[model samples]
Target: MNPFLPMTRQDMENRGWDELDFIFVSGDAYVDHPSFGPAIICRLLEKHGYKVGIIAQPDWRGEEDFRRLGRPRLAFLVSSGNMDSLLNKFTAAKKTRHEDAYSPGGKSGCRPERAVIVYTNKLREIWPGVPVIIGGIEASLRRFAHYDYWTNRVRRSVLMDSQADLLVYGMGEKQILEIASDLHQGVAVENIQDVAGTCYRVPDFDYVYDYVKLPDFETVAVDKKAFADAFADIYLEQDAIRGKKLVQRNGEACVVQNPPAMPLTEEEMDEIYDLPYQRTYHPMYEKAGGVPAIKEVKFSLVSQRGCFGGCNFCAIVSHQGRIIQRRSHASILREAKLLTELPDFKGYIHDVGGPTANFRRPSCDEQLQRGTCRGKECLSPTPCKNIVADHSDYLSLLRELRKLPKVKKVFIRSGIRFDYLMLVKDSFLEELCKYHISGQLKIAPEHISDRVTRLMGKSNKEVYRKFVQRFKAMNERLGKKQYLVPYFMSSHPGARLEDAIELAEFIRDLGYRPEQVQDFIPTPGTLSTAMYYSGIHPLTGEAVYTAKNPQEKRMQRALMQYWIPGNRPLVREALRLAHRTDLIGFDKKCLVHPEKTAGQEKNKPRKRR
Candidate 1:
């Protein structure tokens, strides 16, 4: 019999199990790859002798779909898939997307608009008193009071909205096991309070000892500064070792977030990856063109977890925390060998990375024990003196993978910390240019303005410039015709028209036209989103100028692709708005041609005689 957990009642009966210990309800199609959260959790539970069933993308409008798996003996786990449902459904401009990559056949609206809440509410209607737990990227990051981009308001924690018994945040291997063990021991869900990396609601603040109290929901909802202040307090206390428990009042109940879970050791990471994941979508999805989300990760291997890059716009710091946990080389190479045996074994291993590709170890030794410093970052503004920037272990791993029999190529698609790369004193860049890059190497400089970069928790612009120069020199040394594809962002929290113009000038100097540009979307749990909602820097509490105007944001996006003929008008308008008409004439310094008078157009000189 196949080892995959039962997806239907028939599959369960065939295995001679009358009931399951858990039924995981997900918003994404069932892809039994390790990259999918439901697969990992189910596989892990099964490994511990627990019978698990999966209910993927259940119909949200009614309870019949959710009841397909019957009721679990333990609890029901709910997740909004790998991405937040609203983010998956809409573009940055709040327009509905035509396709959902996580859905079968790339279909739109396969899941509810607010998946976690909808799924949990429906499960409650079907099995009223059963314990329902929410996790994954949605519940993990939004476990606290946060701003919802779609609603355009400060909303209470997802814990309050979903009414789940508990939220298992972060990467859930450690927390979920603990929760399962406790529940199996007959403890009530409400009493499972002391577990790390979990959140539970209470009637008052009495039980939360020595906890930090955040600005109440009412205050943050009406006052922008209070929102910023609340976010600041939450940001500083994310570390596992030094962090304190946090409490936020929501209506009559209080939401309490326990400290972050400690990072896994090398052996622990190996065990998680060694589970028997089919590493592909469930066979049932084969008819509907399969799940599109698996193609990107089918050939990819997640070498590590957690990131210390601390980019303000990213939610990793909140979800994964600012620590790095890596899998051993033996484990990764073992997975590579398994890939070679698969029928679809393309010679290329698409990626061997995580949040940041080259971060194979923690940033520094002290961070492993003392935790990340409060109010200080490892690579933004400047690399800290204690930061140990080394890539020898990562480079060694790549070389080992190259030596495998059937592996033709290996690429690094996940982001690399350019600032950390610049800090390393090795031939990592040369080797990366020679072997790893797939023609064009993509890196994110994000923006050229130091003001905006600072707000982004990115290193100063000079650092990216140095990395670009080094990349060119390395590619030239290797005699390769490779190009550097730099990514830039528009209209983030601290960006203004002048900053966008400066970025446009920077792109002009590069002589490269970007086909795609990112307009900042204030997703929940990011410091940038807090700034977007509050108009105040969470770290500094100073008011910032955010480009909220739709036309202005379009203009900023146009400036990045100024070479496109259709974007000329928007670029011209942007230049004019910034009072930089000098850049509107048809000259070497201009971004777009200025409007010409009829008389001047008629009298223009002609080359023909």
Candidate 2:
């Protein structure tokens, strides 16, 4: 059996290793699956001839759990699991979430808030000079000075706050190996500043060269325009091919972020996924019922990585970069066949996609050579003219997967870029509706208002409407009764009360009741989050309306699910606030009925008493 990485001293001794080259510390329970970031990083290190161990969800209050594996010879790789800790532990309302999918038995509070910073601080206190390199979603997104939604303030770069020697951003395999090789050659961590896709702090300007200087942390913390400007500079230079080095000062220290690592080739992506992952949570957590997050990805195959559908609210572009990196179909098929051998697969492949399911290649051929266009999106406002928007490769891949023996059904559960879908003049949709979708195909239009959609970097309402009509027509032609489950967000920056009301009206007209609506959470390092914090669009330098007040946010959210009886009062209040009381009436178009007075109730005709 392929065993998990050593997690305890005995496991290390069982492997007959005297010393480990690296000890990975993560805020999530040890799930030795490719879907888990820590697992991938550790497995990749192991593949590269390094003896690595893991310390998963160690107690932050003391050093006892931190010392389980002892110090590594090279460095301690740290991460806040797959998600940012605050996002995992708190709802969009900032209320404490009771369940953490990444934790054992789905328990919350397994890790502290600001886990990257907390874990790094603890490690620093215990092992003074050992290198602590922070990455994963928490460190990657927070590598720069950013708006902290929990604190409602601008915070310094995670490198400075966590006091980590180096911070790896984006997908970390390339950077981690480079850092490891340098350290193995006896290069000091402090001197390892030139690695791409990493951020390192320097005492002064002496270490900075050929870099774009963002507005200092102090200036951005106080000045909204400065904050917007700084974020714009940061956002524009995220491309690995043409991106420049970035520097920002936090008090006396300067944080320098090198250009992103080059996109992984097909062979590289294949190699990473082909690592001998045990493909399950560690046995130690079986008593606690294992990690809940594994259930979603255990039988699923990740067909691709990185998304080009640059939704402002999504951080995929920031974390995974825009250039599409996908595994060859043979590799994905190999994984699919592996899933068939699993005891619990049930002949069903849960999903076969990534951030944007349909994106199997770069948005356009030019992006590969010149990087993503500066200040221009491939499929937003409208699909770029140069975008290939081909689905042949993806469709072929899906067809091959469906033919694999013992695979009864293959599904595409990940988000499909509908706008990109619309661009493809092929049988992709027909195959999708007939084979992949299970009665209902979910799509994210986000909002119906063109104004909001523009700000969201999503295709307009008309695009979604056209796609809906096509989907319905296709389902009808196939004599199938399929429905569209559209997702909409509430209270996003640039979305006013009226916009929310308008969305409710659209839902009312469509005769669709949304069971679940997403409320915008302004997490760090996205354009939407920057707009939410600064009240200005970072890229456009224009004022954007954000519903920051809890009451107003509630009202906006209530408008989306106006059909819910419990949300009626807030819906009514939102209608009144938006001066859209016209929607509160007896008409079919009205979202809610007017409140009946006591006198009116008394005057109501009784049935023949």
Which stretches of model 2 miss by more than 4 angstroms? 603-609
Q: In lDDT terms, how accurate is model 1?
A: 0.90
Superposition error at 547 for model 1 (Å)? 0.6
Alpha carbon lDDT of each predicted model:
0.90, 0.92
Model 2 gets an lDDT of: 0.92
Model 1: residues >4 Å from true position, as ranges?
A: 596-609
Which residue pairs in model 2 clash with each other?
Answer: none
lDDT of 1 by residue, 262-329 (tens): 99999998988999998888788888999898889999999999899978999999888889999999
> TM per model?
0.98, 0.98
- Model 2 residue 593 CA deviation (Å) reads 0.6
